[model samples]
Target chain A: MGNLNPIQILVDTVSVGGLYALTALGLGLIFSVMRLANFAHAELVTCAAYAVFALSGQPVAVAIVASVGTAMVLALATERLAFRPLRSADQTTMLIASFAVSMFIQKLLIFTVGSRPKPVDPLPILAQPIAIAGAQVSLLKLATILACIACLGALTYLLRRTSIGLHMRAAAEDFTMAQLVGVRANSVILAAFVLSGFLAAVVALLFVAQTGFVHPRLGVQIVLVGFVATVIGGLGSLPGAAAGGFLVGALATLLQALLPAELRPFREAFLFLIVILVLLFRPNGLWPAPGLKERV
Target chain B: MTAYAAAPHAIRPAERLSEIWRRSATLLVLIAAIALLALLAGQADAVLQRRVIFCLVNLVAVVGLYIFMGNSGVLNFSVVGFMAIGAYTSALLSMPAAMKGTFLPDLPLWLGAMQVPHMLALLTAGVVPALIALLVGFPIMRLSGIGAAIATLSLLFIAYIVLGNWDSLTGGQGSLMGLQTYVKLPVAAAVAGGAVAVAFWFQETRWGIALRASREDEVAARASGIRIPRVRLIAFVLGAFVAGVAGALFAHFQGTLRVENFYLDLTFLLMTMLVVGGSRSLTGAVAGTFAISLVTELLRQTEVGVTLPGAAVTLQTPAGLGDVALAGVMLVIILFRPNGISGGREIDEMWRRRAGRKHRKLPEERNA
Candidate 1:
């Protein structure tokens, strides 16, 4: 097993982490602006995967557009109906509401599409593979990494440059002050949700392309992973969430490779142990928002 | 000092009556319903009785939630983790030798050899989870509000991964079987009743008051010389113990345990029960458990047909449809009455109030 190719594991690590980073970024963006962790972000990703699967015969670009659009709509509706009302309420209410929205959306999908796992065909672009660094890397993985970087770059540009992004930043910093400065909190929040939904679509495509199937429970695992990444990066920091995603992704892969054969199956558990340790020492997270005192 | 002494005299009669009703009626109904359910269980079929017992098991879990959410105002997303610990621990301890040999060959020699009695094993299960909670709570309790929620959620993921992979102890993805089915309807009901009664007693105690004080205003509680972290730690540990006991009961009742059975989905259901019942009251805990459990059962049992102009649509429900429906209804209730059905009162307080009124009249007549 030690003689087995290291390159394959490395490739798997990067691809897995890249997918996680993509989804975690979307969740982080919403958290940054809205200060509410969108539990339904996972379902948004699931919704995207289903959208792609439903549009299988279409052109790849068309399928991608439809998936992203569907996710955006779902995000918008979730924000308007579930989260918007609770935003003014306490944090616990919002958190519970997000869970409800998550369940509702998942069940709705199950009711419509059935609970069985559905086979998904990878887009034509992902069908090819390229040899790199003494290993075979699939086009799907390479594209996932490239697409994630592109999304990251685009998000960075938007948050650092665009007016809407500025309003989002302001709102995240202080909602009351942002409102005082004439930033429409609701619109900015909606934008955050839309952006998150778009990210989820990208991740869903990548995940389904790799796994070749989609299920109602797919979002549960990803949501948990995304949440851990969000905590590792910094609860409300976009870059931190991305970094955390890749970090956990890489950690998970490494543990899978390095753990004794008997312990290999507990890779995710090992990663969570690391998270618990980080949380213990750095309770504020790895990159806590500056100038914010502990609320307690 | 003189002005402060006159405060009780200034209290209005109407305000006092409203306070009494707020705290007592909710508990009265809860106790009466429990008694009614217990009585019905004697006459009910095996299947229906099992469902009632399931509700009772859930009552234990929600009682744990009431301690943390009700008293501390913190949303714990990992009650299922403690429940998992409890379930797995009890299942492993009480599993028969033949079953242990097949799935848990790698278990430590002593654990594999030991076949502890069911009741003792269940107690051990509860203690193990409590100990884990104590260790986990030290740092986690520092996180307030949303941060605590996230941290505990991580704990849930961690627990799931461990339970699923620790094949030696937990039997991995396979079901752990051969445990004695000792948690019958009577035992479950009694445990549930005892748990609710214990919670009520705790709520009126000094530690409970301190925890509530911390929930209301951490800074104020700290200034008042309350050790906030210590208070939260105790609440968390106790909550985990209760959840563990519930898990133990759950394992014995079902006669098998699976790791997947106690994950985020179960956590969501438990949270719904707490929110729907009212996080603040012990009665709310029981109420939420019964309401959500019964509603879930009804939804799964009820069949619906919709006739349209040219077509008919029929829906065949699955086992846990009621849980999902109750979750939906509770979401609406949470939006409106976030405090829950009873506003955080217990069942015993109702009878106590009536009895207190009669006693008060006798004392006044004797004094006159």
Candidate 2:
């Protein structure tokens, strides 16, 4: 392994890790209330990415608003049309439904836009390399880190201060009990979807900026990484999801920097091995929500 | 004779076997009919024969899924992973020595020197993956529901990474070509039928019943002294063996195997087929496979369309339409009939229902 600067690696970790953190946050939010791990969240990110690319000729502000709006609408519609009907269904059933929905959207995009990746240099400014203490960093990475913090900060504020947030927290804690005590289930669930959708849209935009292209099959890796992060942090815990995301992202990028060139391709394999070890030790995850035991 | 028609005096072992046969008669007949139909089609058109054979091979794999996911009520995502192992094993064992030398130069000396008969390779193919499953399926089966899903998914990832990167043995993401094509229509039919019989037999076993009990409710199964993990593991290994056999058949059918063929796409398709037919019954596995296969073939045909009344109009079917259609159908089935088209009931059960009898909800779920 060649020596890499510690500062550069840290920057890489924070930037990449922040995207994963946002992804895990969305998953954790939806899971907290519905107890359904939304497999379609990643697909939603792809949708937003495509949205931005489709609106390339438009002003950046218009594109951002459109892409974010598209993701939120799609999220809400899926919630209303697909998931809401299966609200009381078994976890597996809902999980499978989400899988079907995700695949359906992905395949639809492939058919419509073609599966090939298309170059999308939407924001040249975000891509410029900035020298940080004699280390080069992409402006997008720094922006991603900032965006992640802002989203998390906003979520905390909403969960702590607002009535809707209080209702959401209650529902997450005990869905039936919250409803029994008069928390409006519909609005709270909808809000969760909207918030998560926003996060996905944000992730999608950043992903496009970093990758410089949009492919029909993109976002799967992102979603899977996010999912692993969520599980590692604590499946149902919000803070845990973010922490897990950041930690896993950091570890991944660090591995990329540190691994021998010949062994670089197997980095994911090494990462998964560590994840399996962690689960064996702490099956409930690193930061499990209080009082929740694996019943099965 | 129906199980209902059996002597009511005592549940003798001989009579129980007869009753079991009777209960599964409808499903067995349907499978036999499919075989007969395949043979008949093979007489008429060559391409149709090939398609039917491919579908039958897939049917065997889906049935394997039912044994594990259906019985234990846990979805095993690493099924296609096991199939990859089986396929590679079979491919390596039976490939012409010269081709093996060329394709997989890094193979061990003895293995590279050896060239087994197709029959022997097929048998070994089933055994190897099953043995692997026996050794490694424990920590996975210990977790249930979401935990199991994640674990098995990770298992799939691990398997893909290993198999994909193990260039020495698996041809390193390239096609492992020049394998013998020993799978014929009759052979595929026989394998598929045997798979159906094996799954049905397994479900009648005590372990299968216990696993199903655990599926309905875990605490109660434990209270009744059912060792959930052991039973689930047994089902898992057993399922992997059958899936391995299916994989071996798949390798022989394809004649050239690729690592990319056995991953997320097929894994999810197998799962969808299992879920669509109903994950609860053997008939569900068979029905789901055939139904989805038919839908897919029909959609693929649309990629070369039929002339309409107004004009010789043919809609240009886009890429991945078949998968899209299938996923849409799965979503509809999940929303409307979450248990699947069979609702966990077997074909014979439907016959029994039509014979003027009330259906028995699975006993454990009755009180709930």
Candidate 3:
């Protein structure tokens, strides 16, 4: 702890935090209106990662386009086929359908491409660490942080100033009431998912850049982390989801760096203990919407 | 949407008792049918006997899932977390003294120097996870709906990480081995039968009714004097107890404790079983476990190679065919029967509908 540089750790924390927060924001977008925690988000992220790997040796710009495009298509397709039919189903039922879609897609990928982890080249030059002030940060880390900021900015602007954003806000508050009041249900849901898909692609690209590998299971841990962060942030609250994601990401990184060496291996256990404490303090999550009181 | 109407205010005690008995009797028949399957498997082949035992173990876990998820109407994704805790606890306490000496040198003298009998270890396994669930439920149960599900998921991750990395305790990532293969078809079938009976009985009790009422409408249940969190906590602990027993049975049945087995893959498998079979009743849990296990068995055989009945030609099957087929079937079930195969009704209830003693009412107004 004494030798650790505070600035370096901050950068590390934010980079990881940004990745998680971005993923959570994507998930929160869909969940806000539809109460469905799409397990297929994992698939969408994996689709993006594989796109990058499949397009290796291409220009970075081309690879990014491929990754983002694949995620958007898969996200849109699954929403149309699996989830749309279950639109009026129970949240649990919709959640299960998402799981089935996830499993089906995962197996399909495994069968079609083989279940091996392929090393991804996210541009070798971009892999190098660059010094800023007294701290060193990898180009990938810098990119992830910047991408998160830009995407978050764009998302905020869209939500605040756009007509679709107004519809989305109304829909999230009370989807049925919003529809009853003449909000076009399909377009709002569609826009939320499309933006969500784009954010997922962003998360996937940053994650694959950091790890330099892509596999069918590539997005499992990230999705898990982001899901928890979204929960901790508060369901149906965009700002809460973002805050929760950053908190989890930072806490996770901080725990690893701060713990004594012998306890490092069990860092996750400690993190979980903290999560339990947080739940105890704020059962509806840290930023639960004031109007949505806990009933059960 | 219509306001959720309140349930009828009163029912006679005699009527309640008879209703309970009817539900219990139907579940007993389901158990007996499974027992018959176990007997037939034992007579067929040794491999089938072991496979049947595995199915029974899975039955216990899936029923464990139903106990909380069905009654509470909360989709819990953390039963395997309790299972892992139970299995690891049993493995450590039940390991032979000599092996424990070598494998877990850091184990304190008391736990390492002794090897408890299997039954005692199993009971301890059940109790430990129950207590852990109670502790976890203190916080997690306070949150309802999606928040509750996600918080419980954190518990699962915590259990997995601790079990995977605590090398001296768990052998750290390597499989925990040397567990006695003591769980036979008869033993597992008996335990599973007891699990069904326990679940059925629990659902009839005051706590169970209160929890189910809360599931239907938390505000109405609360208004009627149900302590929502307390009822949920009771179900959580009770469900963890069953999961713990299943975990003990699994460790003995599989002869090893691989932490990875208790993670997401198994969690999803058991949950799918619950959902497809119907997450609301013991019949669904039992039927789902049986159906999925049978399909998996068939798939496993063909996953190597299959020969045509008349033609001599052999066909190579792909790996993960079972998972693919099972998931596909689950999707179909969700599409056609969103309430599950049993449609959340008990066996006797289904029989009543078939006999035309009860007419089908409109489904709860939900989006399709």
Candidate 4:
């Protein structure tokens, strides 16, 4: 573990970084459009994970489809039922409401499914180690990197080229102004939720493949890391979210490789300390979004 | 911003006295309510009495949370982190030398040999966390809105990791046991009442008022020459002090400490209490803790299958329903009453409004 193999470290960093980036995008998309932090985004990831586990008996394709469908439906439902009512309320209220939704789903999952983690191997093939440049990297890591790039590229295309995507971008830039200019608030928001749900579903698949288990809290830690990435990247910036995720992921991996054995257990503490230091220097984040600056 | 700012010079001495007297009513009412609950629990079985003590501990923590979040309008997620710091600090200080020697054998001689009085230990608990908060808040409080919240959340995770992994000092995730359990209902209630009074007093001060002004409109507050970050840092440190005391109370109450206790679950539980009551006012913090504790108690009873006095049926509820119901209640309250059940007004405000309505037949006097 002490050996500093460049290829292995690079693969590990990119794989972890890619997953976090996807998670950040899912959260960042919603925050950009609605100004809601959407703590319930964790529930979307968890529901998708559970769906895959529950449908593991089915064909792999069916399990994947069901999980993706589950995340999307749950995301839409939460937006409709919990968030829509608080649209006119302040940001703090929305954040708390989302927290309640997240808790409700987590507890409900525990009530029905129990808190113990259940192992599921929906894709054993991806776990196989493949030789790459004198380093043994799991096929899952390669797949994760590919998936992250594909999703980000596809999302960028959608935002740049499509009418609905343009509407979303406009809304994110300025909500009230976008409404005045004829962007449909409801549909654009719904589209954002759907796309976020798709990203979360992808994250769930990749995360479960790596961890080999599904549990109620599978999403809690990752979602928090994602939320932190979103903030450090720049709250309302898509590309910034990606950058923050990669930065956090790379730092964490590097810390894991470099810290002494006794200090390794404190890696997250060091990571968070660095995050605070970053914010101290750049209070607005590394790539602050336009229109987010505090104005007199 | 000027309209919302406190009129420091407008009130005459007599009027200021009356206004202070009126605000005291809120603190008095809160204290009386807490005393009433403690009194009732005193007569109940040990279990219920313990639960009430725990509620009061939560009240202290939530009120500490309110001191910063209510006034500054920034969600602080690191209160539990401060609480963890407090708990560990208190436990390490108050534990008997023999116990410490056995558990934390590798401890430095000066720290390991010390065995302080419980009160002194508790005071140190509050002081240490406040010092830590002063250091952490200096940088983090400069960021507003989500940036601040995220930074504080990281603080919490950092605390959890450090406490969980510091094996020599913290017993490495195993419980730190055999501490003096001095937090009886009276001790807890006294601290809770004291926290309420401190919260009220702080919010009425110039710094607190300026913080609230910043909370309402940051740009306007900045334009009015208020230093937002300084006031925020003040409240953050003071709030950490209160949270640390609450943590000490929790440690003595439980007679054991675990890093897990001072993590996400406690963080969210205290948050629910603060927000469900109202994060903007002291009354909201107290009321939310009281209401949620009552609801959770009932749910827990039902989960254990409560039997009526003479009925044959047992009212059995599935386990884990308490958490789900608490979350649901918080969701409903946040939706229907975003300012909480207190609506962000103090008890004195509600009282004055009633009196004002009654005096409508006469010519109106200037409102304080």
Candidate 5:
């Protein structure tokens, strides 16, 4: 373990965490406004990956645009079709419906593209590597980190500065009050979904670039991770989700590095155990909302 | 309580008889039809017998789901994971040494050293999952609403990841094989029937009533002195036990098991069955299971040459198109009639009413 490359590990962890944070931000945004978990967020990520793969022959900018656009469409469609009707229904109904939609979209993907995982070619810009702090890191890793930071900065700016962002925050705080203030609650919610979708697209590209493949079931895995991150950071809190995502990612990487050779395969289980502990002790999450009573 | 005494004793005796008649009629008819079909279609080949056994295996799982979802209003997404635990446990216990050694060479020295009887192995299988559920449910039951669901989903993911990676015990991605297939149709059906009966009896008990009340209004139930978490834990453990039994049956019936087969897809299917069948009634559970299974089978079978007019489509479908379609339909039903097919009413309730009507008519005729 001592002989392992520390610099490489740090770089890798940051890159991975950046991707998770980006994806989680989108998921968190939708959750904050709509109070729906958006289980299909991972599928939007996958759709982005597919979009990139399909447009790989084009310039990198076009490919990225295509991926993000595809995810936006998915986000809007999911909100309009699956969630809007259930907005007034009980929480359980919406949760179940989300699960159903997840299944539907996952199976539809399976039907369209066989169940097998497909290799996705990374863009040429992602291929170049740069040596930093005695560690060789792919240019894409740096780009992903920068992209995540830039997007988060933009999101923070939108939320704190812009009128629409203020409306979104208002809706998040109290939907009825926001509506009374002449905020189009539904449109604000839709905007959150769109933003989340775009974030998922970016994360999807990063994931495929890192993992090299995408499958129908990939979304389920991502959604679970996103959910865990959201819970750990505190549900309905965007910054917390980002922080949680990075924390989980860092912890997972450290655990992997520190684990005895024989227990290396159980790395994920160990990480989840940590999550369980966090949940058990702090049911409201690491960064619970101030002055807000958590519902049982 | 005084209202009971106000009812005439003579009328009670007549009502009891009528209730029995009403409750048993549908079950009796269904049983007779099945029996007749079994007799007429005598000596069904091994493949068809296996298919029937498979349906019964699913029936057991759906019934297990009915106990919690039907009575408690908890959407338990971890049943499939519990089933996986049961399947892998049974598979490890029942596998021949040669097969076990070949696939799971890294199995612990003690486990590799001994071979257990198949029946004991199967029993251990069911017990193991139940025990795990009991342990897990303690903390999980404290969570309410979507929190519980998320916790259970976490459990499912953890179980699946463990099962998939734990190559020593489960053979990992490689299918667990070489188990003796002892799950005949009659045995599977009998087990399923027994599960339904147990669930039915449980539903009538005090604990069941408490659980139902909690489901209706947790605050009111708590105010009424119901230990909500304990009741939920009991439901979770019991449901998990039934799922384990189903898994054991499924493992033996298929003669092999794979971790992937019992993960998210199967979990969704089970949830669909419970929801589509009406999460509030035992009859809905059984009916939903049979209906979904038969429809799935029919769709898979009919995927040959059917095509719709004015569509550039073929009737050809994949292996589990029926399940996908059923899930979609169930989603629609959930959207429109969230109470499900039978809502909360059991078949026995309808039968009791019909029997009471018949008894009243008999008295009228006698008087005439």
Candidate 6:
């Protein structure tokens, strides 16, 4: 085995972290507004991947458009169907319902499109190796980093500079108060779901491009990591969620590189251990939403 | 103040005694229902008997889950993880020394050579996971709501990774076979009955009441001097204990063990059972288990084409139909009847209300 390259490790960590950040943002946005930890977000990613897979023969732009469209529709549908009825229910109920929705979609996918993984190449150009400063990097890694940065920058501008974004921030801070101040709860929530769906679609496209395969469970692990990040960032804090995502990705990469080869397979266990420890120290999260403090 | 308290105290013991009786009756009702099923299973074919036993096993796990989730109102995703620990622990201790040496040669010398009686191994299975929960719960029970939920989910993933990769003791991805097949209908039913009683007794305790109060309103519970985390931790460990025992029962029932058996599929199924029956009461837990078990069994049988007695039509369903149907049923229940089939109330509560109504009606007729 060759010696580990620091720059290469940095690139891999950022690439993985970028995907997780997008997923975390999606989860965090919905949670901030509705107080629901939406497990069905996994299905959003899975649907997008499947959409891309089914449209693999089409141009890359078309596949992207179709996948994004499918994810947004599914997200909006689940919100309208399963979640709306239980909108006033407690957090646990909504969470379990989301899991049901997640499982429901996964099984539906399996029924419709077989359980076996199907290989597809939507953007084969991204798979090529590129050298940067004495280290080998895939074009996919660079694209992933750039895409993540662009998404993050655009999201920041939307939240800070846009009126609807201001309303969203207000809702996250206090939904009742925001509604009292003339924010339309339904439209704001719909906007959150649409954006979440958009993020899931982006992650799905990148994930499929990297792995070259699509399966019913392509999103479960990603969602799990995203969920942990959401928790670590503070339940309803968006920037905190993104940071937690990068933190997890970086920690995982470091563990993989630093631990002895025999212990490498246990990296996920260690990463989760650290997550539990973070909760122990910061039970509310690194950046707890301000509204949570009012509860006590 | 003393005189005012004394007046109520005079009537309190009687009220408490009746309360105890009522609660015991609820447990008796649950046990009797399980016993009836066990009796029916005894008279059935081997396959049917095994299926009923599995339902009883699921009851144990669900009731264990209900101990924490039902009372604390926190979602715990680590139930299956503790089950995995319990299954592997029991499998290791109960397997013959020679077989352990052959398959799990990397186990510690003492563990590799150990071959305990089945009952003792089963008890140890429950104890081991309880100890782990005691350790893990200290950190986990501190967080509330989604924070605690995600922490527990991480715990589940951690357990999966470790159990699946630990080559020596668990045989890695390979199945561990040749365990004593001691969990029959009687055993599973008895254990499940014991679990129900344990859950009921705990729920009636001061700690359980306090935990539930906190679940209703954190600030109010704290105002009443409840140490929320302490009670939550107590329930978490106890729940883990019961779940662990359930896992051991499952291993012995099947006479085989694999890491995959304790992962997402089992987690999803058990969660469905808990949520469908209602996650807030012991009765709901038992009802949910039986209900989903019946539903899944019916759906699975349909997959092979169930034939109607008088009709010429046979219902043919595709494979994996049961899961899809189960998910759909769970979603509908969560949406339309969020409190679950039991409406989150115990069976005795319904009985009491009906009895009270009958008594009231008699007085009304006399007055008329």
Which prediction has the highest TM-score against the true structure? Answer: 4
The reply for model 6, stretches above 4 Å from the true place, is A294-296, B1-16, B357-368
Cα lDDT tens digits, model 1, A8-49, are 776777788988887778888887776787888989999989
Question: B261-350 in candidate 1: lDDT tens per residue?
Answer: 998778888888888887866777878888888887767556343344565655556544554576578678867777677655455444
DockQ for each candidate?
Answer: 0.52, 0.61, 0.56, 0.77, 0.39, 0.78
Evaluation by TM-score, superior candidate among 4 and 6: 4
**Which lDDT value does model 5 have at B186?**
67
lDDT of 3 by residue, B199-259 (tens): 8878778888788878778889899999998989999999999999999899999998888
Determine the backbone clash count of candidate 4.
Answer: 0
Alpha-carbon deviation at A250 in model 3, angstroms = 1.8
Off by over 4 Å in 5: A1-6, A290-296, B1-46, B306-324, B350-368
Error of 4 at B201 (Å): 1.5
DockQ-best of 1 and 4:
4
lDDT of candidate 4 over B187-303, digit per residue (tens):
999899999888888887889988987987888899999999999999999999999999999999999899989987788899999988988889999999998998999999999
Which runs in model 4 stand beyond 4 Å of their true positions? A294-296, B1-9, B357-368
Which pairs clash in model 5?
A: B70-B279
lDDT tens digits by residue: candidate 2, A153-217: 99999999999999988988888889999998999999999999999999999889988889977
lDDT of 6 by residue, B143-233 (tens): 8777777888888889999999999879989999888899998899999999998898888788887887787788898998999989999
> Per-residue lDDT tens digits of candidate 5, residues B1-368?
12122123555767666655655554554444344433433478776666667777887898787777677787678899889998888887777777778878999977876678877887787789889999988887877666667778778878988998887778888887777888886677667777776676666567787888787778889998999989888888888888988998889888888988988778888878777777777777876776777777678666655667887977777664665676677668778877677665566555555567432322113333
Native-referenced DockQ of model 2: 0.61
Q: Candidate 3: list runs displaced more than 4 Å.
A: A1-3, A290-296, B1-21, B358-368
Which of candidates 5 and 6 reaches a greater DockQ?
Answer: 6
Give me the candidate number with maximum DockQ: 6
Error of 4 at B288 (Å): 0.8
lDDT of each: 0.79, 0.84, 0.83, 0.89, 0.76, 0.88
- Looking at candidate 6 chain A, the ten consecutive residues that score lowest on lDDT are A287-296
